[model samples]
Target: MLNIVLFGPPGAGKGTQSQKLIDTYSLIHLSTGDLLRSEIAAGTELGLRAKTLMDQGILVPDEVVIGMIDTKLKENRNAAGFIFDGFPRTVKQAESLDSLLDQNNTAISGMIALEVNEEELTKRLLLRGQTSGRPDDQNEELVRKRVQEYNTKTAPVAGYYANQGKYHAINGIGEIEEIFTEICEIIDSYATQLNA
Candidate 1:
């Protein structure tokens, strides 16, 4: 399976680009945020716990996320590939992801990380909050905190992937299409090698 990790901070256009990648590559989108939201909507036990942590901008426990991913992997065993978004935020989680994929006889082909400046991310998120009604985006303080948290806690995950030569950072400041084109180019390069 052509498993890919779409790595980026909040408001870095990961969600937006994921749709295009999904359409172009026919990859199943595995967004932890979406999964948690579904559970939250259903009022599942995991959702309730995740909600509390998310409300405080804290990442949900790794075990909970790993379990969730286990289910997703089993559910999508026949998929061509999977685009992992909003996951593996920490090095430990990345290690866990590696083992999980190994168990399924697949590995992350690449990790595409969007490199967006803090200023732009803040602007994009606050603007989105106006219409998205997302509590996290609606508050500038919370948004910055989330970004800071990513820098402190999540940025190292990039290094983990880089160590394995599976990390590609793309500029996230250009027009959406332009940024996506850059991402596609990187993914295409990786896909070609995998296929060969």
Candidate 2:
């Protein structure tokens, strides 16, 4: 399997690139945010628990996310690979993910990181918030906070993957297609080497 961890801060275009990678490479897109939203929409028990925390501006526990991911993995057991987005934000989460994958006899192929400036990200998100209607995106203060949280809490995830020689950085300040092409090149090269 060609599992990948798509790493980036908020508004780093991870959603855009993950979609392209899924379409082009036939990898399952496992977006934790989307999964949680689905669960909440469906009104599942876990979703209710998560919703309560989310309503109070608190994050749902990591184990809840891991369980959801575990279910996703089980459902896509025969998948070519999975492109993990909005997940493994902490080193602990990364370690748990590795352990989960190890139990399934597979491992993360690589962590594809998108490098974008905070200022640019804030601009993009503010523009998006105009139509996105997400409060976090609408408020510059919130957006900056989110970015700061990612840098402080989630940035170490890249180091974890780097230690395993499974981290690749791509410049995210270009045309969408241009960025996608670069990401594909990295993934394809890794796939080739893995098979060799």
Candidate 3:
């Protein structure tokens, strides 16, 4: 199994790269944002709870998010591997994820951190906002806030993985295919290591 954690700041192309990885490797892509949105759309109990917190601009409780992820992991147990995106946002969540994967007798084979300049990220986000009609991207203040929040909360998770010697930093700025190539190389190298 080739479990991976895809880490990057907002507008770092994590989503785009994740799609490519999934296609190339037949890996399950587990995006917490997508999962929460699906839950909210379904109006399930967990969705309702997350909706209340999200509507208020507050962070959803960790347990709720973790529980949702736990369910997804079980559902995808038969997959060759998984790419976790937009998850393990905090150190606490990272520890929790480690425990959860350990219980399933799997471990993160590697973590790919996409590195992009803040200016480039902001420009990309603004363009995305214009094209996608995303309210958060449309507002400069909100975009800045999101970037800051990601730095404050999500960036540390990279360190957590780094300490485990599973972190690979990849340049995120470039054509989509180029970035995907970088990520693919890292994953392929890890696969070779596992096989050896």
Residues 8-122, candidate 3: write the lDDT tens digits: 8878999999998999999998888788878888999888987776544456778887888788789988888999998888989999999999998888899999898888888
| lDDT digits (tens) for residues 1-196 of candidate 1 | 7788999999999999999999999999999999999999999999999999999999899999999899999998999899999889999999999999999999999999998999999999999999997888999999999999999999999999999999999987789999989999998998899879
Q: Rate the local accuracy (lDDT) of all candidates.
A: 0.93, 0.90, 0.86
Q: Is candidate 1 or candidate 3 better by lDDT?
A: 1
Q: Between prediction 2 and prediction 3, which has the larger lDDT? A: 2
lDDT of 3: 0.86
TM-score for all models, in order of appearance? 0.98, 0.94, 0.92
Model 1, position 14, has a per-residue lDDT of 94
Q: Residue by residue across 1-196, what tens digits does model 2's lDDT show? A: 9999999988999999999899998999999888888888899998898777755545578899998899889998999999999899999999999999999889999999999999999999999999986666788877887788889889999999999999999898999999999998999998997899
Record all residue pairs in model 3 with backbone atoms less than 3 Å apart, i.e. clashing.
Answer: none
What value of lDDT does candidate 2 attain over all alpha carbons?
Answer: 0.90
Candidate 2 has its poorest 10 consecutive residues by lDDT at 51-60
**Which candidate would rank higher by lDDT, 1 or 2?**
1
Q: Which stretches of candidate 2 lie over 4 Å from their true place?
A: 55-57
What is residue 43's positional error in candidate 2, in angstroms? 3.0
